[model samples]
Target: MDARLNYFGNQLGAKFLKYINSAGHALGLSSLPAATQELVKIRASQINGCGFCTDMHTKDAAHAGETQLRLNLVAAWREATVFTEAERAALELTEQGTRIADAAGGVSDAAWAAAAEHYDEEQLTALVSLIALINTYNRINVIVRQPAGDYVPGQYA
Candidate 1:
């Protein structure tokens, strides 16, 4: 299926993406763990139903040595035993953050406190930024009806 528009082909869209991608790269250099970052991206993408992002992040995570089992279980993370406490906290935060409209109060204090217990201030900052960034990307992709399953790991890098 063809996208409604080539977001990369338009000058304005390309400029927007350039800055967005730059911010993502800087966040990647933060104290947040790479594995955790990818997991967060995958979970948020799943929640948003952004197939393009789900494909991209899962492929990227696998290329970085994330096990297929863990990748497959991200959507079922709440019941999975393979994740660490820190990862679980992050996933919970991601869910709350992604589904903010569903919950009138937004991300709960409990989720924030749980994540705080696992991450430092800088890591938390990165996590928040990553969540926002991925959400933006997800919206853009979903609106454009971008196709999935052809992404190669590190294709954007």
Candidate 2:
């Protein structure tokens, strides 16, 4: 299916994307674990129902050697046993952060404390930024009706 607009091709969209992508690149260099980063991206994309992002991050994770079992279980991470405690905490934070409107109080202190137990200040900063960044990307893709399943790993790199 065709997208409503070629967001990456239009001049204004390209400029906006350049800035957004730079933030992603900075997050990539952060102290946050790479696996946790991918998992957070995948989970948030799933919550947002952005098929384009789900496809992109899952593919990117796989290309980086993420296990198929783990990738397949990301949506059901709460019930899954393959993730580390740190990863679980990050996922919980991602869910709360992504669904902020659903919870009147926003991300709970419990979620933040759990994440704090697993991550350093810098890592937590990256995780928070990553969540916000992925959500922004998700909204853009969903609004533009971006199609899924054709993304190659690192295509935007």
Candidate 3:
């Protein structure tokens, strides 16, 4: 299927993406574990039903040496035993953050505290920013009906 627009080819869209890409690049330099970052992106993409992002992040994570089993189980992370406590905490926070409108009060203290237990202030900052960023990416892709399943790992890198 064709996308409604070639977002990457459009000049305005390209400029907008450049700034967000810079934000993502800065996040990459943070103390947050790279594995955790990918997992968070995958989970948030899954929650948002952004097939493009789900495809992109899962492939990127796999190319970066993420296990197939773990990547497959990201959506079921709550019941999966493969994840570390910290990873699970981040996933929990991702869910709450992405579904803020679903739950009243917008990200419960429990979720925040759980994430805090696993991450330092700096890492938490990166995590929070990553969640917001991924959600933004998800919305754009879903709105544009970006086609999925053809992304090459590091294609945007």
* Model 3 agreement with the true structure over 1-157: per-residue lDDT tens digits: 8999999788999999999999999999999999999999999999999999999999999999999999999999989999999999999999999999999999999999999999999999999999999999999999999999999987899
Q: Write the per-residue lDDT of candidate 1 for residues 20-56, one digit (tens) a residue.
A: 9999999999999999999999999999999999999
- Compared with the true structure, the alpha-carbon lDDT of candidate 3 equals 0.97
Q: Per-residue lDDT for 1-157 in model 2, tens only?
A: 8899999899999999999999999999999999999999999999999999999999999999999999999999989999999999999999999999989899999999999999999999999999999999999999999999999997888
- After superposition, candidate 1 runs with Cα above 4 Å error: none
lDDT of 2 at 9: 93
Q: What would the TM-scores of all predictions be? A: 0.99, 0.99, 0.99
Q: Clashing residue pairs in candidate 1, if any?
A: none
RMSD of every prediction = 0.6, 0.6, 0.6
Off by over 4 Å in 2: none
Residue 143 lDDT in candidate 1: 97
Relative to the true structure, how large is the alpha-carbon lDDT of every model? 0.97, 0.97, 0.97
